[model samples]
Target: KERFISLTIKKKQQDVVRFLEANKIEFEEVDITMSEEQRQWMYKNIPPEKKPAQGNPLPPQIFNGNQYCGDYDSFFESKESNTVLSFLGLKPRLASNVVLQLLGQVTVVQ
Candidate 1:
């Protein structure tokens, strides 16, 4: 499913937009630059710990059906790990029974 992205007109935000476009990922963008209310909303909604120390919340704050998926670092990490599909819930979290056993949720007989 598509997701939402909060952004401002900045290099980092632009990079994220370009990344999503290149990947053909569907997303709705909210421009914090145009709306003070939106900016404040973003500031309030995003957890304080996630914000940078010196400024308001940065752009490209991604949301997966209302769940904050994190910023650029986390996003790219997911991409690099090929976990985007899993993050999007497009694929099963555990690809094999071995994962379940590793998590101590199942017993492996071998």
Candidate 2:
């Protein structure tokens, strides 16, 4: 049972890392298993409502510069809804916006 849980955690962590890398988002992975201080920090930063009713919250917790984003399930939902950038507190790219400057005239696309 413990091994199964560990595997599940590992998979979730991998999924998050893969998505972040694919999107070219810079992130730092902290291994709570290696340091008690890091583990405590994670637990402390998580919002009270997000904490599990039982044991400590599992890994694969997402954050944007100390601001807690959410857990693995939240990340999956955001990905499904195409709101990952907003979920991570990132500004969306202006892909559809067009900017043109011609003859000292500026045009902005909204």
Candidate 3:
């Protein structure tokens, strides 16, 4: 799944971008303020219930491929749980480290 985020040039949007960059996450940003068509398209694709409670229905909307993954809060939650990698169809590096540690614990009898 490709990582995509819809956002305007707002402070909150910038914060999300910063967070992703700090975590070394790759993502494509669609600036809704720059493109009305994109803004409208985002609105049409994301259901009202899924939209933020602010009622503006504007950006910072995060998505994994075509699936809407909520705004910054949701993204943060996924990040905290280390599920964002899985959502992007990427192998979880942390899990792999854990697996390797487990393997290292096993000692074969001579």
RMSD vs true structure, all candidates: 13.8, 13.6, 14.7
Residue 49 in candidate 3 has what lDDT?
A: 87
* Residue runs of model 2 more than 4 Å from their true location after superposition: 93-110
In candidate 3, stretches whose alpha carbon ends up further than 4 angstroms from where it belongs are: 1-9, 52-54, 87-90, 93-110
Q: Please give, for residues 1-110, the per-residue lDDT of candidate 2 as tens digits.
A: 98898788777766766776686655444446766776777788789999999988777676665677787888889999999777766678522222211111111222
lDDT of 1 by residue, 7-69 (tens): 222445556556555655544454455666755655666677888899665455654444455
Estimated TM-score for each candidate:
0.58, 0.80, 0.56
**TM-score ranking, best first:** 2, 1, 3
Local distance difference test values of all predictions, in order: 0.47, 0.63, 0.47
Steric collisions counted per model:
0, 0, 0
Residue 42, candidate 3: alpha-carbon lDDT: 62
Q: Candidate 2: count the clashes.
A: 0
- Indicate the residue-level lDDT of 17 in model 2: 63
Q: Pick by lDDT: which candidate is best? A: 2
